[model samples]
Target: MAQDRAQKNRPHYALASVDHALRLAVMLQVEGPLSVSDAAERLGVARSTAHRLLSMLVYRDFARQGEDRRYHAGPVISLTADSQSRTALLRTVALPHLHALVGRLGESANLLVLAGDYARFIGSVESSQALRVGNREGMVFPAHLTSGGKLILADLTPAEREELYAAQRWDGREGERPDPAALEQELAVVRDRGFAINKDRTETGVTAVGRGVRVGDRVGAAVTVSMPTVRFDESRLVDIVSALALASRDIEHDLQAALRVEA
Candidate 1:
């Protein structure tokens, strides 16, 4: 839901290039294939600037150039790994566990990483049930408003928090920002509980539970299980949290083994 709102306020002191890149990425995600000229027009940048940005995106696997010369969502959008970038590796390692989680819980699950102020879902597995949460790969959500996002936010230090969410940064988007004191209290609860649950915080009729995946000292990603709110059972929270933890551990173990092999 990166483009969930149509008229989000521009951040104060926002870098034009970075903003353009992120917006272009979202456009590719939400609107499908786009020509360079169209990208330039959408971003209001010179064609050369758009081309350069598209080149960078191609290099990072965020986009792929088709034979038609249009840019489209790349393998990264589908969580395919070329075994080069760490993000790809993360998705590769996490997917098996995500599928296992879906099998165990009968709910869709996703692996997400912190991307600037948003949480980007890098891998996702949908449940087989006729009525279930759908795939959410390649989507971004405000970090403060998602279960996985809150876990990533809780991992940040106070100074890091200030640096990322400083008032000046949200100048035009003040209405969308979380209350500082409330956010601190919520993060405290997230840290203390070792997991997070969002009951329709980002989307109505959906609920998600998340646990952090740690890579040595830093939390690298979050493993989350999402389901329709009608099926949510608070009484089953403990069991769901346990399954998420097991999946997280499996992913971490694989990541470590992969690193050792690389070393």
Candidate 2:
């Protein structure tokens, strides 16, 4: 009966195409580059089918093709390797600051880091209020959809942002995928204001404010406060931003100290 219940809880169907693509993605991450024939042989699929799968991966920035006709992990995947250790360290150093933000703002606070084209919640401190937002650690959301993501994206140069968006494959759902032109404009506002705000953008009735946490010239992470729209007050945004900025600086200081220790 326990086994049966577990089976019932699992997804009933799996798309072969999706499974194939996922397998290929894992291989690319773990084993590095591969050619079409290599992927076909490994997956036991036809070369033509492998090419189609690879094309989708390339379109999504999960993989890239080189002049030698070999496919390696793309910018997103490469960034993952570059940022993984830093992200782990940031999470450890930012936890106390996140808690402090929650105490000051009475709203849930999170530490997010960029992982490829998504923002990953690395640490969080829930608000004390009964109706407050809950912890979101381990959640991954598209970078363009969340305030934290937008804040980090705003740090990238226009050309870098465009390159990141060029091969994206958009979902059919409205607002699931960002329009490049619109995103460009929104990022401009983020840069000018030194922060980003999302009101009912990522989720209905949810609002978030975020600012980038920098390690020198680069944005290393983002600090965010989230609350229900009903509790959101535009008048308090400035104060909230102030609290977050202070918390970011605190985290940044600790991160620098930690790096110096390692050095």
Candidate 3:
């Protein structure tokens, strides 16, 4: 019984040690270089054990031990990230649908992700028009004033919306950020309407309509079709809204499939 108890405890202790080593590596990645003693202190392990873990990590190129004896994340981990980003499975899956919409409508289409208090434009298909009104890729804009932002905001719970707005300092930033009561009213209408519209809110002559692009239970992102107000009159608005809704559904389906495979 004593020997069996020792055997069981040995594997548990080994796993704990491995866990500590992984924690040390992750800490180095997040907090930059750390001496062995510092890593040991943060992990509540002895210097010798930390040294052994660092050696193993260095051998695998997960970390590099510098002349200063401080450890930092190394090329192997960075290469893995580069590889994953290059794949960009979301963009790959959505491209066909986005191109179809752009080709059919002759208006710009974009994919946006909510980052901090803003919507970041990740990808876009430019309108074929001689004059353009849509945002360029990699542009970041206030979420409270754009159709993509409104689409994302409309899907959030009231509590979640309050938390986001509080962090963003919306009151001071936007001249037209609706008061909480008014925002709540607008959000209710957005939810019922199944899409959101921006009427020259972000830029003077541009108008856009957007719909939520969801992945599973999470509102992963949004899609928008944008044009100048003169080009997108009331009749054209209906066509654009309908096209965006279809494109959103297609993107959501692909996003869900990609996520399932990733899982």
Candidate 4:
């Protein structure tokens, strides 16, 4: 029994629950990522207990809930410095495509990556049209309120989504969050369609459509086109979606090639 304990020397006064939580944290930091069920199985605990433990970990920023619905080492974890090389490579491969998208649709295009609970615009190309939306590069927006943000958030599992939008987090800032039911309905639609559309949701008189840039089964980023609301005709939606999809594919292809070369 002592040998099976998390530590070689099990303390007489060690609280089992605390030990379990610590062990889970270690597993997250060392094992990369794991689901609640996986943690429970490994820790020999009940599912509810595992969930409570993981929630506490998230609350303390000891672990983070990933888009894949697994827990990864949070910022507080003492891992090696995160390399910005991936983001740099992604931006390098995606800039040309953003410009091409602007040339094709005559609308501003942006490339964004998930940053914590926000979407960070890393690449942007403004349209030449007099009435077009301007460059939004280096801007960060609430993940739930942006076109690309919603598309990426919709890709997370239900448990991961719950952690991100936990009721307690919105206590004083209720207005900033969307109605749970309405947001769920919209996310379901975005998931089914593999894209998202925004119309005056984040900014007034601006409309946008976004598609995820995928590398194999994982989405690496979101590519979107934003235009003036007056020019956002419902008839043009199909064309906008098609253009956005092509841009996404182009970015993903180049990103894959770049990463392959690096590997």
Q: TM-score of every model?
A: 0.72, 0.67, 0.64, 0.67
Clashes of each: 0, 0, 0, 0
All candidates' lDDT scores? 0.83, 0.80, 0.72, 0.79
* Model 2 Cα lDDT, one tens digit per residue, 156-216: 8888787767644434433344678988998989999998987776565778899999976
Clashes of 2: 0
Which residue pairs collide, candidate 3?
none
The TM-score measured for candidate 1 stands at 0.72
Candidate 1 per-residue lDDT over residues 122-189, each given as its tens digit: 77889999989876776778888888989989999999988888889988877777778889999999
Q: Model 1, 181: alpha-carbon shift in Å?
A: 0.9
Off by over 4 Å in 1: 1-84
lDDT of 4 by residue, 1-263 (tens): 21122112234797979878877775565346779999898777999999999999999999999899998878786454333456657877998999999898899999988876678787778899888886666566777777898888888787877878888877876556666778789899998998888777667678889998885576658999999889999898898899888889888888888888988
Best candidate according to lDDT: 1
- lDDT of each residue in 1-263, candidate 3, tens digit only: 32122111113345867767666665554346779898787667899988999989999988998888798777765434433342245556776877888887888888777766678666677788888754345556777667787778878888888887673675554543446777778778878888888876666677778888885576667888878778877777678778888998988787777777877
For candidate 3, the TM-score is 0.64
Model 3 residue runs over 4 Å out of place are 1-87, 167-178
Query: What's the distance in Å from true for residue 120, model 4?
Result: 1.3
Q: Name the candidate that leads on TM-score.
A: 1
Candidates 1 and 2 compared: the better one by TM-score is 1
For TM-score, candidate 1 versus 4, the one ahead is 1
Ten residues in a row with the worst lDDT in model 3?
1-10
